[model samples]
Target: MFLAMRAAVEETLAATLDRLGYPTDDLGIEQPPDDIDAVLASSAAFRLAGEAGAPPPKVAAEIADAFDAADCQYIDRVDTQGPYLNFWPSEQYFEHVLETGQDDDYGALPDRETSVVVEHTSANPTGPVHVGRARNPIIGDAVANLLDYAGYDVERHYYVNDAGRQIATFTWAYETFDESELPEPERESPEYEMVRYYRKANTYLEDEADEAEIEAAEAEIQSIMQGLEAGDEAAYERVSEVVDTVLDGMYATLKRLPATFDEFVKETRFMRDGSTDDVIERLKETEYAVYDEDAWQLDLPDIDKNLVFVRGDGTSLYTTRDLAHHEWKFDNFDEAVTVLGEDHELQARQLKSALEILGNDTDRLQTVHYSWVTLPEGGMSTREGTGVDLDDLLDEAIARAREEVEDRLDDRIRDDDLTEDDIDRIAHQVGIGAVRYDIVSKQPTKGITFEWERALDFEAQSAPYVQYVHARASGILAEATDGEGINADQAVTELDSRALDTPSERELLRQIARFPAVIETAADDLHPHAVATYTREFAEAFNAFYRECPVLDAPADKQGARLALVVAARQTIGNALDVLGIEAPDSM
Candidate 1:
């Protein structure tokens, strides 16, 4: 929706400069700062100020004059600010900004339409998902959605490490321990049972009661894993049972969280299909890999750590499976994205270098390490069964959201109006939104200390606030729908501005019109937080407008026009939410 306007603006600027005898190619511009009230701003003329051998203010004034002389019909006024120039939209231009985007192709970009694969939330299937693991999918799903929205043929994937020792231990511990297996739920966390068993396994190992017994258990697990890797029919089926069982419950919790993957790749598949060996050979043949002491290692070119890809026994490590995985992705997608936590920075970076080592075009694959902030409380370790379990976190978020809503609305909403269905819907929206938006509201590189007050604040840029704005827009439209809704081609007046006469109204229009640009920026940077931040900007603008501009109580013709404006604003915001894989319920 914004592509056309951007092109038109740039083209008009270029044409205006060319007609005025300035070199258009050398001149560049950017959208004005959001904090400012200007329509457009740039310092292009600043570059030529010294060449013109005149004062910067004089140069800026001349360029501004030249731009104003151009026949572009959308701009209201142009002003010079020393070396910078600014453009302000006329009220008519504000109306045009709404109607202007009707035919705009905002979503699709030139980089889209080719299939891209993103592997995210590929948690060790030993236990439930954790808060750290949640970051990957929260970001990955948004990335995939952005790519798709931007017109890329995209696929979301989860690489299951079903053959890993972690799974073997988890399965081993589960089968060996019966009713007594569950650990003491001292603190009663979400993963109380799982954590209990994990601690039990460690405790058993630490006791050193019987070396033979412990060795026997290890051998049994290895045999099972080896069988699955070697395509043993029974072993594969057995492993699948465990995977299916955990995945069923895991996916259930994830569904509530609302992130999904289209494909689930198994690490064992590499072993069964012999691709893992092929990748190992390719790495060894090239000078990219070397036999280091006993293990197979990537050279890493001295810029980073030499990565261990395989053990001396030829057992595949995470890096080995990843090498094979990248080969698969390169053959399958035009782009591949890896959203992982910060702890694996070295390993993930080495994985990319390993791909470059194994004869794949480094340019063909774009690997992004979307590192997330870890809770300062602790980190999750399989052996210790520690960290924040995602299932538990989500449950807590929902419970908190429910309590918050029910706490306030209990008196107003009677037994007849407030039902399970309504509560669930609201809780889910706010709970999930709170989680997603919490991280998304900040740059991913920045750490977040989870705070309940911030997460559930309905007045903050948190989920509830934005969702409330969406609901408010709907309520206004509901009252107007009795006889109002502008026809498809209804004409709007220059004076109407849709009751957009206040500072807030102007701000709202600017924000509504800026949605496409914001989305494009977010997509380009692979940053969903940009979109999140924009949602708050838009919501704040809507609130301010709501507070000052009387949409429903304005002149009837003007009120109807303003309703149309609100509809467009709501639509644009909804679309933004959709791009983030969020739902803006019509009634919130």
Candidate 2:
């Protein structure tokens, strides 16, 4: 609906420019300033004035006079202010919004029939998932949700780094631990046990180990890598066991955020299927491929760096495997969206460049590189055993949410028939929602210092506040039985737009009307944080409308109109929360 209105306004401006004998090629429109009493504003007149050698204000007036409101269905008036022409929406636009806002598909766009592969959270399965790496899954999942809402066919994936040295190190640590000294896997998760020894192994190699011991470990890891690369049954079984154990714990952590993947692509699969060797041969045929010493490298003079494709030891680098993986992605989907860390920015670029060198269109691959996340104490390292475990973080969030929920529901606990289990369920939702929203609400390229107080603050810009507003709107609709003959659904279908003329009501309607535009923008920019920001603004507008407008106490016509607005606000907020992967509860 917003897009339709903008199109109508633009058409009017273009027609006016054509009628005035001015070029319409560079004409554009933008949102007016808050002080301006208009829905759509444009400064095209200023540019047109310069082009036509006329005064800016005089050109603006001429364009305003030339605009025909009768030609535009949604815009009613066009007025000139200084060097701008402002367009206001007609009553028909508000009526259209009111009539269509009750449906679940209110803000959705037509399906574009494009398939997108979103790959993210491919963390090395070396330890339990940590807080430092938690943002990837949240942001990635939110992007997938937004794309899905925007009518794209999105396939979420996790590219497992199961063939890397990290996995070999994890396996070696698990195998080298003294059996009697190791914790029982039955009592503790295998990943948890492996992480303890993994840290010990790294520390031993770094500090206390002698050169002989270091060489032994390195040789063991290399042998394991070679065996896996050769598709040895024993090597595959042993490595798969360790990778599966770690992934079990990782998937459990991911489930807490409710993030799931449609597929899990193994890096070793490319090695076994000969895609890696094929890519190496292809690169070798290109002028960019150079034989440096005993290794094959891609000499990128543009970046003044040479990327090694094959080591002198005959092993392929991570980039080689990534190139093959992306080749598979491009073959399967129309587009591939990768969410990786800022540290991998150069690797992502190299992957695209290598693909381009191989005669493939690299533009199909979109990479979103997010910055690091840290706690208030400082940075975290998994190998040092210094990061907050995801399980521990969730436990703390749920515990804090339990306290808040109990306190909020203390007075009505009995009246609402609430039990301990109910409190637990609500707390789980609130806790996870808070964590997900706090992590995903910030711009992905910016670093965030995760703070407990800020994340769980109910009055602040958190998920709980938005969820509560949704619940509040729900409560109002549920109690809207004023003994009148008017039905809520019927009222929505028969809504009267003039009854919503109050400042708060119109403002709320305007916010609700912007939902589809927000979703489209987020999907186009690959920025899920925009949806989070929009939901908060929508919630604020709803709250203001609720406080200032009398709903059930108003006259029959006004009550029906306000009720329709309530229903629209509730539905829109719920949709926004869904896109953000947060729960919108009916009650707190």
Candidate 3:
């Protein structure tokens, strides 16, 4: 309803401005400040004050006087306070919000008819995903979900880094190291099992082995890389097997985070299929390309350093291969969003600059650079073999969540009998939801420390808090009519906007009305945290209404309207959680 009202307000305000003999290009409609006590406001008068040859307050008064609130869709009246034009919603607006909230597709936007590829969490297939880099997958998946909800056809992708030196080192370790020297598997998973080879190789090179052994190890790794790039089919097949084994383990952990990819594009494919060579050849002809220090480099615009695409040995760098990968993405999808760590910002800019120099449209590609996720101990490094594994973090989350669930079970036993299976399922949902929400709820540019206390706080601003509100509303609805619950559709039909008169009820109605607009803004800005913020606000509004407004014990005519409000709040909260890829359980 907010989206519809905003559009109507814009159109109506533009007409009013045109009548006042001022430009109507940007009316500067904005949300009113807290002290203004208005649903929407505009500061266009300030922008047009010079042209109108009058003060902003006078111009605002003139526009408000000319505005026809009765004709607008949801706006009831407009007032000029100081230099601002504040607009309030009509009773008809509340009626529409209550009726629409009961629908299953409450916050979904109209299809935009664009297809997008979201490439994220392309962590090296060397070990299980760790908490340090977990932000990539969580943010990437949530962004995809937002796009999908925004009506874009989105395909999630993981660009497998199989052609890098890391792969060569992992392969070398698996094939060269003695089986007797490898440690026993910790978790009986392929990722856990295969990473030992890489870790052992790293430990030997960095700490244990002598200089001669290190030289031999590095030489063998160099040979494997050369062979892979030189199109040695046997070497390619062998390394591919190791990569697939590790990926199996990685996928197991990703599934627990509930992140899935529609495509697993191998970087080696670009090398084998001549796409990498094609990229190098194109860069060689560009004006920015220069042969310096026995390597081909492109002097990027506005940057002091040149981007190296080819090394002294003639092996193309990862950036060059990434160019080929992006070209593939551009060919197949209308747009692509790549998620990367803050450390990769330079590489991303270089890629775009090189793409521009190649005469390709670089606007089709977008990059979201996020800071690292740290622990109380410090940062993590897969190479150094230090960091909390994603599996371990999730395992501990579930165990801790189980204790919370057990305590809640004892309190609610008289109302609902939960079996052991129910307890376990609820534990997983809350645990995973806490982790996902904790990471995705923060601004992508900021780093976060994963804490169970904050994430699982039932009374605080967390996923469990939001989920518990959902369960509370469910309990209220279920207790009505002897467990049959009020028929939400029927209640919506009989909903009376006049009966929803209390301040708390009005606030909740306002929050429910803003759901569609919140999603649209988040989708446009590529910010998933916006929806998370909205969900928290919506939950708070519902809690206030629960405290002040009676649902089942309301006056006879007000009962159905209050029940309908509950239904809408429950559905909107659930839908918001779904957009974040977090489950909204019916019970706590």
Which has the greatest TM-score?
3
Model 1 per-residue lDDT at 165: 75
Cα RMSD for candidates in order: 3.6, 2.1, 1.8
lDDT of 1 by residue, 310-348 (tens): 788667787788789789888888878777777777777
Of 1 and 2, the candidate ahead on lDDT is 2
- Which structure among the candidates has the greatest lDDT? 3
Encode model 3's per-residue lDDT on 1-588: one tens digit a residue: 778889999999998888879998888988788566567899999999999899999999999999999878888899989899999999888899999988898998889999999999999999989998899999999999999988999999999999888899999999978878987877899998898899998888889989899899889888888887888898799899999999989998998989999989998889999999999998998888899999999988897889999999888888899999998888899999999999999899998888888777988888888998887877777766677888888999899999988876665682566777878888999999999999999999998987789999988878898998788888777777453435544566876788899888988988888888888989888999999998888888899999998887777778889988888898999899999999888777
- My TM-score estimates for the predictions, one after another, are 0.89, 0.95, 0.96
Candidate number that wins on TM-score, 2 or 3: 3
Q: On a 0 to 1 TM-score scale, where does candidate 2 land against the true structure?
A: 0.95
Give the runs in model 1 whose Cα sits over 4 Å from its true position: 16-26, 68-70, 90-93, 100-111, 174-200, 370-382, 410-420, 483-499, 585-588
lDDT of 1 at 552: 62
User: How many clashing residue pairs appear in each of the predictions shown?
Assistant: 3, 0, 0
What lDDT tens digits, residue by residue, belong to model 2 across residues 176-260?
8776655443226656766776776788789978999999999999998888777777887888988988888888779889899
Evaluate model 3: give its TM-score.
0.96
Winner of 1 and 3 under TM-score? 3
Q: What's the C-alpha lDDT at position 209 in model 1?
A: 35
